[model samples]
Target chain A: MPSRSLWVPFELGRPLGVPDDADFQIGVLKSLLGLFNRKSGPVIEDYPIESPVTAETDAAWSCTIPLPPLPDTTTPAEALKQALLQEVGSLAPWHAESMRRMGRTSFGLSGLTPESMPEVAAFLADVASGENPEPLSGLSEPLPIAIRYMADDAKAYYMEAANEQPGSDSPGGTRMWTWIYHETRMGQVFYDLRDRLASEYADRMAANGGERPPGPPPINPISARFAVRPEPTAP
Target chain B: MVRLKDLPKEYAEGLLNLPIPDYGPAPWTDAPDLKDARVAIISTAGIHRASDEKFAGGAADYRLIPGDLDFAELTMSHVSVNFDRSGFQQDPNLVFPLERLRELEASGEIGSVARWHYSFMGATDPSRMDETAPRVAKLLKEDGVNAVILIPV
Candidate 1:
């Protein structure tokens, strides 16, 4: 079977929409479900369009997978990674076309190597934390604009710094911020954020590098990889 | 002082008099009828379970948690949700309001809840988004869900 079926869009770990706000979050969840309503093979469509830059609206997206017997989380996760990397590479050409439509000028595939995953992850940390750091060098065009590294601990802590200040005294913003801060406090986000850097051995490199995994199988899950802090009692 | 672009006739008559909340979506339409339909949620603020092994502060996942927003709860937020995983927790208000939804579901205002709902962290990326999003759709299809309520938390 396929190493992985589909992927979800949000952050790396957080799968659902939000932790609490069931209504709007569920709306997003339903959007994901809308994907499977397709009667045929896997179909892709965009929805809930409120803006022109719809895809990058930073809104989360999801898909569904029927649960019969999932491979052990570890095996599937590993296989899924290979699948994801293949998907990433597969879309490169399409992304090039998209860049052309978006008025982008250049793309540097070499810059997206494992060596670049940490930098991209750092840039994501910066962007999520309101840093808006510069893009990785050599990327003349903004195709795909993502990097992947192996799973580790330190990277985990920084990746979770994705917090915004709470407003209106509502608990939503504060609760998520608390979660990320808690991750940072636990130092796990940092570790996962740079996992590939930790395991950059020569053997780690896939022969295809820019292609899908071999043997139609071979995946690993970064299981329970996120580090959570103890919740404090609210007075 | 009304300019052509800021004409009042084109806007609401009581626009100036309308009291807007400082945060959250401004309600224009009546509340959605949660009858005989599944209500799914999508929070932009990254959310994830601390228990998931392949967690990251990016890539939103839409795993549903049952009975989180009941009335008996004091302030049941998805605090345990992992932001390091979804990053959508950047706006927790978007992610952990299950306690609130559970409250609504209990009042009988909402019809039978779906067996599953969804979540995913928020981040920026343009290419291959559809590829990343299919997992949520697969879950909903399997759960037999119909309606979804997207929360930009």
Candidate 2:
């Protein structure tokens, strides 16, 4: 078993679901719920791809997704659509509004109209909302590039931390709650389709279903390292 | 785990004098006389614009991607953070902490600022950084940066 808690499904930085998208945001929480069920029982979930490789002409964007090979299920086009659907299924209608609000509060923004777009949202629509559900293992080409990038980081950081200094031992190795928070604080990026990035988090308890203390809404911070660098290591 | 007061007093003094073009104090202490340290930043702002690609895989373990768009304006669209601008105009901590790093470089706390930095949208898988960090390491190496700070957005 990997010696760490797994948390992926919120915003790009804080993978616990953004506060705004109340309904769909729960997907992040649900995902966490799923994580708890993995009792050394190989828990492997697949993510659908978002964005079309052919549409990806810009080298910068192209580099980010690293378009993968066509899935065996169908044509590359079908694979692309399947990828987009899963993303859309996990999203909320207010995704844009929430993102805008988030951008305003955290990133800075101009407005939510058509003209002020920083980047084209449609391109993502194709990829994120597509429905080709396949294990990340099947992806090759562009996407594997991105996935391998993240997996390698997680593995290395843990190894590096082990070498640096031993961490505090909460009951079961790293507490699920603390581990989740620590990883997010360490700068864990969630797997796709926007609305899941929320910083407010609490260790999931059998009684508390995992909700942070409520109140005080001043742009919740998610692991300061992400706020500035990677969240301070739990060592 | 550095206490606030314990932090170099120069940093606070500098933060106060920012937007003035010349912040007098150093950015970080504890850092060895950083003549050429490499610095990198990680953003949880989930910032990749519609222009950038979202994360891939079961980060069901890490929440990320297929972000919605707010076509309204581009004030801070350049950045992907979800911060409020009420306090950030004169100081732009929202995007990447360019101003802050610049202040450090100006004060000589850092030998020199790396020309380029990394911007991870923050919601994807942190486990998969093996793929991301190297890209940054490569970029930094190409630019001749020695150490990386990794400013979180």
Among all candidates shown, the one with the greatest lDDT: 1
Which runs of model 1 end up more than 4 angstroms from their true locations?
A1-235, B1-33, B54-94
Expressed as tens digits, the lDDT of each residue in A106-183 for candidate 1 is: 122223433344444345444333333566676423422233322222222222222211122212222333333432
Model 1 / residue A228 / CA error / Å: 28
Model 2 misplaced regions, further than 4 Å: A1-235, B1-32, B48-91
In Å, residue A204's CA in model 1 sits off its true spot by 23
- At residue B37, candidate 1 shows an lDDT of 49
State which docking tier applies to candidate 2: incorrect
lDDT agreement with native, every candidate:
0.36, 0.32
lDDT of candidate 2 over B45-143, digit per residue (tens): 433343344433222111122112232221222121222222122122323443444555676655565555445534344555556555655666787
Interface RMSD of each: 18.7, 20.4
lDDT of 1 at A11: 34
Q: Which ten residues in a row have the lowest lDDT in candidate 2 chain A?
A: A58-67
lDDT of 1: 0.36
